[model samples]
Target: MNSASVISVVGPTGTGKSALALSLAEILDGEIVNADSMQFYRGMDIGTAKVSVAERRGIAHHLLDILDVTEEASVSDFQRQARQAIAEIQGRGKRAILVGGSGLYVRAVLDVLEFPGTDPRIRQRLEVEAEAHGMAELRARLQRVDPASAERVADDRRVIRALEVHEVTGKPFSSFMPVREYIQPTVQIGLDIPRPVLHERLSTRVNQMVDQGLADEVERLDQRGLRTGKTAGRALGYAQFLRVLDGEATVAAAAEETIIATRQFARRQSTWFRADPRIRWLDPREDDVVDQAAALCL
Candidate 1:
């Protein structure tokens, strides 16, 4: 492996990626660059399970809390920032450890991914059409233009972006998808845990967050324009708890919903990361998992 190669710790949520990344950084004299999209927003800490300053153990971490809740995060911008951070870390003679469960964001840093540029006029036109015609209409249009992306994209935001890409660049959005090929020397370590174990862990973690005043945290952020945040407002716990604030649900109900949503999200994450052949899988339950991962990096 190249000495300056990036070490990426990736997996589903509640799989101990952060803990392993911390251990790897300590052992390899590394700095951490966050790839989790949710962790980018300030005041999103408790819900995102952001590692605290004390928990970081003085390890320099880049790209956490860099955006306000109201601002949307762009994968293209993050790719630039993360690569710059990695280069700076390498230039200082320290390894750069990339950590997070956000699969697309991770790939944006490690893989040969190209993001399509957006034109606001085109996006606004699409948005208006969707509102006037409905998502079913828009989805049908997308199917006509880009069958692959239409099949893959489910959300309103991405569907519009796909149409916008087709309009502006006259190319399918799927064409810009990341290839498995790495852009640089990299070793990706994926934590493998049983589905049953992961589900239980996610449930327990969500409950713990509730006990730790996740509602209060959400309330504080809500006062800070969190509701206006297109990305952060829709996060796993934050969205559910936002209902609590609206009197549409109780805290317990929100926690239960968050647990179910998180488990589903984790399943999607597992599917995404498992598709990548480059990642070396380690059962985090193993006694010598850290040693095994360190050996791969070395």
Candidate 2:
């Protein structure tokens, strides 16, 4: 890896990426840049498992807690902000360590990705159509217009965006997909964990979040227009806990649901990162994992 190139720590959730990133930063004289989309929002700490200030060990971190709960996160915006942060860090003669499980957000920063322009009129029309007709209806439209994106994208938001892009740009949204080519000389370190162990860790983590007042955190954010926020409202634990606040589920039931959802999300994340051939995979269980990762950076 080039001495000035950014280092990324990526993998599924609960795989100890943050701890490794912190260690790498300490060893390499690096600053941390968050790539997790959910971690962008303020007052979302507990459920997102955002590292606390003290846990940072005086290391400088960027792109975290910069948005309110009501705002939607944009990958295009994150790309700009993260690149600027990386450039500044490099200019200061320090390494830049990017860390998160959000696959697309990470790619947006490190890979040659370009976002298509958006028109409010087209977006609003699509949103209204989705609300009136349903996501299945829009997804069917997406399937007809951009079958590749339709097959790959599973979220309602991306489904609508795909359709909007096809309409506005006269091209398939998949055409804008990033190639694996990196924009800079970079090294990605992925943490590999056993499936059964990851499942248990996710379950235990969700239960611990509940114990650590995930419910209270959700309740507080709900007052701050969390439900009105399109992106934040759908976050794994927050969504289930919101059901609890609505009397639709109990805390125990919400925690169980969150565990299942998080496991599924982790599986998707693992699949995404696994597809990238450039990342160096390491077993986090090994005692020399940090040393192995540092050696790769050098």
- Per-residue lDDT of candidate 2, residues 1-298 (tens digit): 6878889999999999999999999999999999999999999999999999999999999999999989999999999999999999999999999999999999999999999999889999999998998898899888998999999998888988998899889999999999999999999999979999999999999988998999999999999999999999999999999999999999989999999999999999999999999999999989999999999998
Candidate 1 lDDT for residue 161:
95
TM-score of candidate 1 to 2 decimals: 0.99
The CA root-mean-square deviation of candidate 1, after full C-alpha superposition on the true structure, stands at: 0.8
Q: Count the backbone clashes (under 3 Å) in each candidate.
A: 0, 0
Q: Would you list the C-alpha lDDT of every candidate in the order shown?
A: 0.95, 0.95
- Candidate 1 clashes between residue pairs 3 or more apart in a chain or in different chains: none
RMSD of each: 0.8, 0.9
What shift in Å separates residue 236 of candidate 1 from its native position after superposition? 0.3
Predicted structure 2, TM vs. truth:
0.98
Per-residue alpha-carbon lDDT of candidate 1 for residues 141-192, written as tens digits (9 for 90 to 100):
9999999999999999999999999998999999999888998899999997
Q: What is the lDDT of residue 239 in candidate 2?
A: 96
